[model samples]
Target: MDFYHESVLLKETIESLNIKEDGIYLDGTVGGGGHSSEILKKLGQKGLLIGLDQDIAAINKSQETLSQISDNYKLFKTNYENFEEVLDSLNIEKIDGFLLDLGVSSFQFDKGDRGFSYKVDAKLDMRMNQDSSFSAYDIVNGYSKEEISKILWDYADEKWANRIAEFIVNARKTKKITTTFELVEIIKNAIPASARRKKGHPAKKTFQALRIETNNEINILRNTLDRMIDRLRPQGRICVISFHSLEDRIVKDTFRYKFLDCICPKEAPVCVCDKEREINIITRKPITPSEEELKNNNRSHSAKLRVAEKI
Candidate 1:
């Protein structure tokens, strides 16, 4: 399958990076190398671009796309959670800029066999890396009803999580939920008819919750943000595009804390604590896709791009 993903907010994200001609940049989630291609376009021969993705397919496809242009970089088939270690191994102590586009790539959803889309009928597998031991099947069949409900409600904000979890538990008892279509049918039956008639697909949120859980998405994002910020050179910037409210909230809060870390009490403001600000928030509010971009690609509707510069 062709590694195809329309880079969301392409120009906007690259512009936010303020790319330096000879500086080093990292694309932590370099899906299909779309944004990475644009990043390399702005670099001189001395500039370096590191592309990272856990999916072997993505790494292969992105390398094929980028190899035609420049070879002054590296590609890694590893999770972004270990980006700090990867950089250290490369002898790169700091970066001039970095980017992270969080969420499943279009390739994963388009290739039905990967089981990322609710519309597709495939096996219940949602591992970003094929080597992962657990997949969506494990969560759907083995997780307790309460655990499933919590993931659905917290990760996807699905209001009918309780009913969906009940339905899943009941179905699994009769037979293991091994395929995507079976789970989709169960989800449809669990939701009310009126609710099913609503705008979006009924199984969207449930599938999103399962994928996140299967890949450990939320925790990885929360844990990696601070470490990535620490790796930026003075005055270097980091831009992140998150596809859900939970991810956006984590990025926003991390940026806020890093910029306003002086936790001196208001009552006695004599600077008792020695904490100092690390980065300055560049975007007061996240930049969303323009109406034109939305019309071109609706998948970009949920994307929120936030930027910060290391102090």
Candidate 2:
């Protein structure tokens, strides 16, 4: 299947970057190269764009998409967490700007075979890197009920976490839950009919939770934010588009903490902790999709864009 993703917040993200003509830039989640393409358009011949993704499909698609625009970009099949190593290996010092659009891509969900969508009936295999040994199948079939429940609640904020976990444990006793549809069925059964009707899809949260656990999305984001900011040149920007509140909160808190001029205890009358502010938070509140964008792409509805500039 073709790797196609509707890049959310395209205009807002590009504008947020404040791209420089000859400065180096990076797209950490270069799915289908949507934002990367626009970034390239703003770059001069001396400018560089490094595109990174864990999915080989995204890398390949981005390579093709970007090559059509310019040969000035390089695509890497590595997780964004390893971006520092990539930059170091290339002898690159600091980037003028970088972007991370965090979450499952439209292609991943639409492919059906990738098993990211609750509406699909494919095998339980939500590995973003396909090369990864762990998968949704392993989590669903092998994890303890307690573990599953915790993942559902923490990652997805699913209210029926306990019930869903219990139902999954019980159903697996008869046979393994090996497919997306099977899990969807279990989720539907676990959620009361009245409760299910109150929300969008009954299986959406469970599927999201499983995908996050399978790919270690949250942990990667948590570990990489500071490093990513540190990699920016003075006055450089970092724009992140997060799909859900969990991801948004992490980005917000990380930026908030990093922007703090001091971490001293309130009781300290005089200055103590000399932590200097690293970056200025550009958006006190996140930028959401415009109504026009929401109408054009339904998947963009949940996206929130946050930006910060190195001090």
Candidate 3:
């Protein structure tokens, strides 16, 4: 399948970075190279754009797309969590700006074989990196009911998590839940008909939870934000576009904490902690897509872009 993903908040994200013609920039999740291509357009010959993605398909597709723009950029087939190592190997101590678009590419969901969508009937395999040993198959068939319940509740905030977990455990006892459709059936049966009718797809939250757990998305995002910010030069900005509430909250809290001058308790008379502020929050609120963008691309509906400048 061809790699296709509409860049969400494209103009807003690029503008937020305050791109310099000769500065170095990084696109941490360069899916389909949509955002990276736009960033490349603003750069001169001296400017550099470093692209990173875990999916080989994305890397290949991005190469095709970005090569059309310029050959000055470098592409890496690795997760953004390892971006620090990439920079170290390249002898790049600091970058002028960076952008992270946290949405999964449209190709992943639309390609039935990837098993990211509950609407698909393929084998349950939601590994973002096709090379990863762990997958949705392993999580669904191998994990304990309690573990599955926790993953659903914590990652997706699914209210019927316990019930869905119980149903999965029961169904797998007869035979392993090996396919997306089988899992969807279990989810539908687990959720009451009235409740299922009230919301969107009955299996949406469960599938999202499974995909997140399979990819370790949330934990990696949380761990890498600080490192990405640290690699920014003074006055350098980091723009992150997150798709869901969970991701948005993490970006917001991380930026808020970094922007704090002192984290000491209010009751403390003296500023003994003396925590130095590392960043200035550029977006007091996240930037959402325009109505026109939302109408043209349904995927941008949930996107929220937050920016912070290294202080």
Candidate 4:
């Protein structure tokens, strides 16, 4: 099966941007240009869509995909966290909108050799930027038990973090855990038989934690929201599509932080703490896929789209 990262919440995401025909926009993840192509369709002759992706494959794929739609787009080979540099390079002062489709793409997991999926028995390499030297292999084999445990808990909320870390450490002492299946077997063994039978695959959380660590996705997303909002023009929109609770929480919290008018406690009458609201939270609650969309794309089951507009 040809696995393209089908854009999740395509209509809602496009509508959230409230596309301005002659305005400038950015697709920070540009995975396979699924959203970018749609953004391209909404752009007029003067409007421009600038896309960025750390994965070279995505950069190339989006370059090909968006080209079919129009020539009014540019793809950059870098992470969204460094979007400032890319914008400066192009002399772009501010953008009218920004869209971030966060987390791993379907293409990465489906490819198998990239190792983002637990079902795939490929080597444990989940580096979204294939050029990067660090990968799941390093974390699985090289990280300390404590570090591994923390990653599983903090990144994935894995209940079996400590036990899984212990299992990984003990198993590696006998032999290096080099492949995806090797780690998957260790996770299955570490989790109790009852817990393993609960819900979803036993190795899912462990794999997710490793993938997050390998790519430093959590920190990047945490640091990027404010900067993206800062770069947006007045009344500009920022749309984020997050795949899991961890990511959805970050997006929600960031929007909440920006939506705040004052943080002063109710007890204090004076306003000493000068915290200013930044953006207006457009989505009172995150927008999820429709029943039809959920039925069509099982991978999008956890997806949530949250939007905010610059104040």
lDDT of 1 by residue, 1-311 (tens): 78889999899999999999999999999989999999998899999999999999999999999998888779999998888888998999999998999857788998989998888889999899999999999999999999999999999999999999999999999999999999999999999999999999999999999999999999999999999999999999999999989999999999999998678888875877888899999999999999999999978989999999999
TM-score of 4: 0.96
Q: How well is each residue in 78-100 modelled by candidate 4, as lDDT tens digits? A: 98999999999999989999999
Candidate 4 least-lDDT 10 residues: 1-10
Structure candidate 3, residue pairs in collision: none
**Candidates' C-alpha lDDT:** 0.93, 0.93, 0.93, 0.91
Candidate 1 — what's its lDDT?
A: 0.93
Deviation (Å) of 114 in candidate 3: 0.8
List of clashing residue pairs for candidate 4 = none
Cand. 2 Cα-lDDT: 0.93
Tell how far residue 33 is off in model 3, in angstroms. Answer: 0.2
| Model 3 spans > 4 angstroms off | none
TM-score of each: 0.98, 0.98, 0.98, 0.96
For model 4, the stretches where C-alpha displacement exceeds 4 angstroms are 1-3
Residues 35-78, model 2: lDDT tens digits: 99999999999999999999999999998889888888888899
Arrange candidates, best lDDT first: 3, 2, 1, 4
